[model samples]
Target: MFWEPLRARFTREALTRSFVALRIRDYRRWSIAQLLSGAGAAASQIAIAWLVIELGGDGIALGAVTACMMLPTLLLGPFIGILVDRHTRRAVLLVTAVAQMLIAGVLAALTFGGALELWMLMALSLAHGVAFAADNPARQLLVMDIVGRERMTSAVSMNEVIINGARVIGPAIAGVLLVVSDAGWCFVVNVLMFVPSIFVLLSLRPVAPAGRTEPADSTAAAARPIGAWRFAMHTPAIRATLLLAVCASACYNIAVVVPLIVADVFHADGGTYGALAVAFGLGALPGAFFSATGPTMPRSAEVRAMAVAMAAAVLLSAGAPTLPLLFVGLAAVGMVVMWFIARANAFVMLSTPTAIRGRVMGIWAMALPGSTVVTGLLIGGLADLTDPRIAYGAVGLVTALVVTLSWRGLRSAR
Candidate 1:
């Protein structure tokens, strides 16, 4: 049956992840650990947003908190990349998971004691940011170490699917828990969920990075703060993917406009927001699944498909008249967004050597967060001038132009 072959192929891709990287035992262990860790991270993020709202946060406060969570990636990600190259990737990941678990515990305590303040929230956010800046590069680099390079695209896509799968499950559970008790319980659950990750990571047999390690007593490591940037700029495919990330992120203000359209126009509430999130998550899941399977299509073909989908999704969202219609548009947008991200990350992993994979991915990390920050500020100002709907429409137009102008560069990179 057609279904049998499809199922067989997917099973092969999923089960053979370690084979692709050429180290099944280590990669399997690492992948499981990452899945656990990613779920906890997603849950914790949802908890933070809800906690802020419960404490009377306005849009600006929400923005500030979100920015705090993101700013480290923008500011310190490059330096973290250097660290990823210098240190043991597995050790870096373990330390980060432990640090994040501790942060969650503190947040839980503060919430339980009714002593949580905006400053405390900001401080915890900063701590999480630092941990994330290091953890991201470490994890990306680990894909290379455990798997090598044979099935990198599969590994990258599967990793995303695992993360997004958690995204889908985490929020629904958090929502139920948030209504049943305080947000602190959400944090507690996150701490508990992270245990499996820490355990799995520890269980993996240690595999050092494939290249030369930096010397323990070197001023050289101290001097090369922006070394990741230098490395990525020198590598054509990595640079191209980073640029694509920037453009895609800038165009993603359609997400920002979703709540505005629902609340101001359709007169909806928080539940509607959750539905939109779920819709988007469900739409994106399939894209990740498809990419995880082997493909006869050129990488360029995949990227162009993503670009077209993004353009259409944006245009549809801008013109959506009702909540239901808007969700369909947002979901379509989400599907393409994942496609673009997973493909770009795959490209980065393929192009970079194991030695510098972390640094290169760190540069990729900087592009999306930095562009989102800029785009958020611009969209906020535009919302003041006109309705968010119109502002979103204009963004869609700009992104379409991005597809037109940037497609060739991306194609060349592949």
Candidate 2:
């Protein structure tokens, strides 16, 4: 019985991994654009956060700013998904990238002019959030079209590496740039970085649109958007993966808690925070690179491995005591988190039909930022009341519980 199930699953997994559209040139161009876009996004985020703090904004303000940036994924994502299905994805991405550049340019101008305000900052963040909501689904859907459904899993895994690889450098670079000049320079860099993506999108030869057109009837077209959520909720594998992801996000927020711990508990300074982040980044890079090499087991097995890894990371974070110990723990955590992300993304890409790919991905995006935002607020409050260590430890416990409960669903996905 086990043999039969394993064989069947392997067949499906193999089909998912095979790339039918790899010969296409435009797709490669799109991938390059996406890689640059991810890097620019990371740079912009680090810069914006630092800008808030430098302008006398407190933790609460920082949280609000982060929330504003993510809130659109929850609010505008569904409709954006609909638009992605209805519009040319290349056009959509091109417009959004340009819009993002303009938004950053405006902020850069305000900062240079010394006219930036709390409300203006918040408003700009919200706009960026909206742009993100539109941008993400377009990119995800375009990937499917570019690579075809077969190789989507590998493509997604590789994409995660590209994005996170940029993340590893973006914050560190932002730190140095902020020290050298000011937040305005970061925004300026972001604006210039986005230009490459815009050029790539514009230069791509036109292909047939991958998205399906909406029905002529308003009610019919409106009815389709909500179905994506309904479908995800009903799918045991998808639902479980998302639940696991939420837990994973909570566990991953240890990165946030670590800096606070370094300052408050270890009585360290900025260098300590940088060291921990660097260690985490170093560890995550290898993990992401390994994930791109291919599945450890079958695809489903890989998914289950991610769930197990997440649990391990949570426990590691909770058990860390010394600064060196915590760095080691964080490195392990980073490795696992990277693996889990690659596996989870591959699962989603493999499982979803191309027609509804963007909306399904929108649902995926919703779970991540929504969980991160909630956990960030919860952890922030807990850290203030007791200690960052205790707060993160508690969150890790919660994360472990979530992973344990969701193991079966993950197993099925493989």
Taking the tens digit of each residue's C-alpha lDDT, what string does model 2 give over 223-322? 6667878888878788887887777776665434665676568887544554565567667776776566555333766666666776777567656778
Superposition-based RMSD of candidate 1 using all C-alpha atoms, in angstroms: 4.4
Candidate 1: tens digits of C-alpha lDDT, residues 1-414: 636634654675455642354247766766666666666666676677656656765444545665666678888765666567667787998899889889999999999999999878878987888888788778877776766655665567668787777766666666566656777877887888878777876776677665554477367655554575687776654565676677677554333455556556787654565566667767778767666664523376567667667777877877888778888887787778777777666667666676556556656777876556566556655754687778677777776776677666666764
**What ranges in model 2 sit over 4 Å off?**
1-32, 56-59, 211-217, 253-259, 262-278, 296-301, 318-325, 352-358, 408-414
Residue pairs in candidate 1 whose N, alpha carbon or C atoms collide under 3 angstroms: 21-147
**lDDT of every model, 2 decimals:** 0.68, 0.69
